[model samples]
Target: MARNRKSVARLLIKAPVYLVAAWLLGFGFFVLTLPKAIPDGMTPKSDGIIVLTGGAGRLEAGLKLLEAKVADRMLISGVNPVVEPHELSALTGAEEALFTCCVDLDRAAPNTAGNATESNLWTQTHGYQTLVLVTADYHMPRSLILFRRAMPNATIFAYPVKGEWPMLYLANEYNKYVFTLIGEAFKPAPGDAGKQAKSATGTL
Candidate 1:
């Protein structure tokens, strides 16, 4: 019994260390795979485009893609409620007509997860099956995870924006991605289609 107790204690102490090491290795791999530069002349068409706010140049990139006819519809997820479409066009230098007819502003999402939820609903509402997802490169991994969970049937293409981000920001995003992965692992399988549709439409 004494030998068993000692072995148990050793295992308990070593478990956390192993877990942390595994997590760090996974995080490093994720960082290494992130896009370092924006792709040029590689525009692939999709059913629509969804841009998650928070990163610089993301909106402009989305708009440019739309202008290039990459997709006919676009959603700027997580927009501030106060910002008008014309104001966004002015900021991005996109023509006002482009946004007036084809763009939607989603003010409901307040974070990456919320952006996924809101974009999923918007895609469903518009009958979109494929989407071009625009966000910062460091954020794309977590964003893709949540978006895939929220809309498993949709085809999502990442269009990561390259920018100068501080190390602290990258580290924080990495932690969030790790936490999200762990959380999703233990989550129960989603319910039927009706229930899922209702859940996606509701606020996160």
Candidate 2:
């Protein structure tokens, strides 16, 4: 009985250590696999482009892609409610006509997950089968995971923006990515809100 108790205690103590080791390994792998840059002179055609806010160069890149005719439409997700389309046009140096005709502003999303939700809705509304996702390099993994979960049928291409990120930012993002992965694994899939909305609208 004493030997069995000792064995149980040993297992209990080592269990957390083993778990920590596994988590560290996973994080390391994630860091190594993180996207460094979008390829130069490579324009991937998609049904639309979705740019998540909170990083420099993303909106401009998406706008350039749109101007290059890589996609016919673009959704700037997570826009501040105060900002107008004209303001974005001025900031991006994209023509006002382009913004008026093909660019959309989404002010509903407040975070990355919310960005996915808003993008999914917009994609369904626009009937976008493929999307070029623009965000920071550090944010791409988690963004991709949530976006994929939210829009399983859509083909997503990552266009990560390379930047000088602080160590703290990288660490926080890495932790969040791991936690999201674990949470997603256990969470049950809810019915597609976008599809339901599309069905009701009877449009794209």
TM-score computed on alpha carbons, candidate 2: 0.82
Candidate 2, 27-112: lDDT as tens digits: 77877888978776585789999999998899988888888888999999999999998899899888899999998999999999
Considering summed lDDT, which 10 consecutive residues are worst modelled in model 1?
A: 35-44
> Measured by TM-score, how close is model 1 to the native structure?
0.83
Off by over 4 Å in 2: 11-16, 188-204
Q: Which candidate achieves the best lDDT against the true structure?
A: 1
Pairs with backbone N, CA or C atoms under 3 Å apart (clashes), candidate 1 = none
For model 1, how many clashes? 0
**Per-model CA lDDT versus the true structure:** 0.90, 0.90
